[model samples]
Target: MRWFLTVLGVLFGITVFLFLDYALPSRQTVRITNTYNRLTDIGANAIFYASADAGTVQNAAGQRDVRFIDTVRPNGRPYVYRNEDTGWIWPPYFKYDSSNLHAQATDRKSTSANPEWVSVTSYGWRVSWLSIYPNAISIRSVAGPDVRPFNWPAVLILLVLGVLLFMLWRMWNQFHERSIEPAIRSADEAWDRIDAQADAARDRARGRVSRWWDWVRGR
Candidate 1:
């Protein structure tokens, strides 16, 4: 019985561990990305505008054939838009591309570096972008931190099982204790009754022997 209890306890512990490790989302991460490209010949002086009903932007790469990469968001919504007429293209996901633009190119040796023309705005779940034409904007995905919520049902079940096991252990102990007590009491009672019977028999024998001796002497 002791060994059985020990085994049951061990199994319960293992079950709890497995449920938490695999069944529960102890750690989670999310990232979201959005990309846009300019279709019109809006010169460097003019700003390019692109709107997405829902999403986010990370970083932009390349001036013309730009590529954007980002993590998926927790909410899991990302959108992409492209201008069909200008040959401008924006991928819904991460990809590489190479294309030429009529706009001024930023030179590696130039003193006045071209501004990192990237803009990010968050309006609830929607993201928008604006930039000069002949250009493409790549918005990387967003990344979210890991999180884990406690599993109440599993916890409750474990608790209940633990309580039941404890109760069984207590009951077993009580039963053994009670069983021994009754057996011991019965043995003691039987010994007492036997002793009483032996004493009565001895007294009766002495009385008969004494009476017989007196009769013979008197005769």
Candidate 2:
């Protein structure tokens, strides 16, 4: 029974550790969308500078525009960019310059227009994937599915409770085992002593009886 409790305690500890490991990584992924936005903002600023001379535009800082365009993957699933700053506000046919502005799949490939100006914005969107990762060639957007935060406080509480319970059980077991040990030893010793005394008394009685018989018989 003691061994069984010890084994159970160990299994509980292992389960807690595994849960923490799995949960922590997923929490990190939740922050990925935010991180990607920061990268996109940086990329957008860079494109703004590269697109035209800073002096050419009036109210350059205030008029700066950023939008995210919703696009479907090849699998026909909808994934809108989390950053509203980079989405497409207009249809694909709207021309940025002389060329029509079509929704291009966000990939690493360089999609440029006939005129370099049109390509400037499109290329900026395309190369924005590079900002996500320094050496990444492909822009694979994560499925913006619902994600839950790792309930760290709850986990911590559970761990603490489990540890306390395990310790209490262990201490109780030890105390009970120790409590009975001395009583068991004392009882065994007392029984042995009693048996010895009974044997001695029986032997003495038999001798006395024999002596009495001899005296009586006068043989």
Candidate 3:
């Protein structure tokens, strides 16, 4: 049981880490290679894409227009992102600036050699097997690829999340120590008292009943 519990705890921690890593917005300073509209077929891969814009219609159709930003990382690696409005869904990006972001990306486009570096803040991941790409939330021009952007947003989010988790831990500890442990202890004491009473009653009736050795042994 101890081994099983330790394994379960490790798995849960890894799962939470991966979840936050993908859901939280991260900033990357890279050079925009290009930007364009991708007529994507959204079948089972719809969850990877964002919902329709606030006023846009969300049809049951299999295809939709998704904008993509192609860029090369600071370490000279290519990165492709799908731009879409989150439409008040998971991750709570509330990003409704698809067109405006596209324009900004287009304006910031530069070559790999010259590298007009920009900081792109985005959330989500690119799973090549699932054909899903990260959604770029915002972008701004930076000095160069080597310039590291200070992630105050991520820091603030972590602080809030840490405080929430700490509060939850405290609540769980209080509930267990006050309620669960006391309940279990009371139950154990009650059972012990009942057992003692039964034993006493058996002793008191032993002489009142006429029983030979054979009867006592249940002949």
Give the per-residue lDDT of model 1 (tens digit) for 169-219. Answer: 999889878997788889999999999999999999999999999999999
Query: Which lDDT tens digits does candidate 3 get at residues 90-144?
Result: 8787777889999999998988657798999998898888998989999998877
Candidates in order have lDDT scores of: 0.39, 0.38, 0.86
Model 1 spans > 4 angstroms off: 1-145, 184-219
Alpha carbon deviation, residue 112, candidate 1 (Å): 35
lDDT of 2 by residue, 146-177 (tens): 32334454466568878998999999889878
Please give each candidate's TM-score.
0.23, 0.27, 0.87
lDDT score, candidate 1: 0.39
Q: Rank order by TM-score, top first?
A: 3, 2, 1
Candidate 2 global TM-score = 0.27
Count of residue pairs whose backbone atoms collide, per candidate = 17, 10, 0
Per-candidate alpha-carbon RMSD to the true structure: 22.8, 21.1, 3.1
lDDT-sorted candidate list, best first: 3, 1, 2
Best by lDDT: 3
Clashing pairs in 2: 66-85, 67-85, 67-86, 67-87, 68-86, 68-87, 68-88, 69-87, 69-88, 92-101
